[model samples]
Target: MSIAEKLSQMGVTLPDAPAPAANYVPSVRSGDLLFVSGQVSSGADGLIKGRLGADMSVEDGAAAARACAISLLAQVRAACDGDIDRLDRVVKLTGFVNCTPEFGDMPAVVNGASDFLVEVLGEAGRHSRSAVGANLPFGVAVEIEGIFRLR
Candidate 1:
């Protein structure tokens, strides 16, 4: 029924919000919009890591991308005072995939995050998205950022 319950139904667990790696805050809000910093799949116990379509398979990249999405949501929850249910709409998402020069499955990899959000929030998760291939992404295979319009 609620977003948190939906996550539980899907067996998705949100980790503690990771601290920013640089000068940026994890999430910032101005007016009714909340912008989350780019989140890379990192610093968990033992996540598989490497360049997508190079050292990793498509499935791995997808998984990493999904992880990044959850990190973004964790930041959102923290920013909105530990309640993801308060978000009314996920407005936009931009994802970056670190891949080999010839890799072209970037969209599929990013779908991991897009799909995860939809599963967690149902209709509220729908959003515009961009999935781009990059030379590198903070040394990880996937990075995702999100913008949410909250109630």
Candidate 2:
């Protein structure tokens, strides 16, 4: 089935692609690769704001990362002219988690996005990834960026 159909089977409804919060394009294509800008943890309820290991739990941070992933996919869909199936493979993901200096579970937190992508796209979703703790913009719990190979 197509990627869009897969998303539907997973009960995911992509939100409208969000406008860039700064003077940057949401996604850019170069040759056969597409790079997506960092996407914060945002949804209909608004940004998921908190610092892990301080006020939030690892599970909550993971959820925030998952939300960021969803936003990233929305940008990717837009870059493909509203068709996510144009994506051939996920190349890499860089995830940043807002957390206290002592927080050391960044990898687990980012697994939320990684696992979701694998569930949705199967083998094409497996990719190199980095999960790091950092002070994120707007005090959001998580931010994620992606690189994809286009069909």
Candidate 3:
């Protein structure tokens, strides 16, 4: 099945690709690769804001990370000129989690994005990743940037 069909089966409808929050564009293409800017955690309800190891639990942070992944896909779609299937595979993801200084579960929190992508895109979704704890902008729980190889 196509990526659209897969997303539908998973009960997700990609939101409109978000505009850049600063001078930088949301995505840039070089050669066959698309590099997407960081997508902050957000959903229909609005930004998922909190600091893990402080007010947010691991599960909640994971959910926020998943929202970032959705936004990443939306950006990817826009980069492909609305044809997400042109994406060959996810190349890498760098995830940032807002958390207390001692927080040690960053990898598990970022797993939210990793697992969701794998579920939707299967093997193509698998990619190298880095998850780290940081004080993110706007107090959002997560932010993720991605690199995709286009078909």
Candidate 4:
């Protein structure tokens, strides 16, 4: 099935690619690899912001991570000139979580994005990843960047 079809089946509608919050571009094409900048946690309800292990639960952080994943796909679509299917596979993902110094479950939270991508793209979505805790900008719960290889 097409990526759009898969997304629809999962009750997801990719939002328009978000404009950059700073001067940097949202994504860049370097040969066959597309490097997507970190996407912050935000969705229909607005920015999912908070400090994990302080106020937010692991589940909520994961949801925020999922929001970042959705945004990453939107950026990928934009990079592909509106054709996401041109994408070949996910190469890597670097996830950052806003959390207390004591909080550890970064991997579990980032799984939200990884799981979603695999659900949509199957084996192609599997990729190397790194999940780390940091004080993300705007206090957003999670931020994720990705590398994609295009056909």
Of the candidates shown, which would achieve the greatest lDDT relative to the real structure? Answer: 3
Model 1 alpha-carbon drift over 4 Å, by segment: 46-48
- lDDT at position 125, candidate 2: 95
lDDT (tens digit, per residue) of candidate 2 on 38-127: 999987899999999999999998899889889989999999889889989999999999999999999999998999889888999999
Q: Give per-residue CA lDDT, model 3, range 40-144, as digits (tens).
A: 999998889999999999999999999999999999999888998898899999999999998999999999999999999999999999999988988899999
Please, what are the lDDT tens digits per residue for candidate 4 over residues 25-69?
Answer: 999999999999999999898899999999999999999999999
**In terms of TM-score, how similar is model 3 to the real structure?**
0.98
Question: What residue pairs are clashing in model 2?
Answer: none
Clashing residue pairs, backbone N/CA/C < 3 A, model 1: none
Per-candidate Cα RMSD to the true structure, in Å, reads 1.5, 0.7, 0.6, 0.6
Question: What is the C-alpha local distance difference test score of each model?
Answer: 0.85, 0.93, 0.95, 0.95
lDDT accuracy of residue 106 in candidate 4: 98
- Count of backbone clashes, every candidate in sequence: 0, 0, 0, 0
TM-score of each: 0.93, 0.98, 0.98, 0.98
**Runs in model 2 with CA error above 4 Å?**
none
Q: 1 or 2: which has the higher lDDT?
A: 2
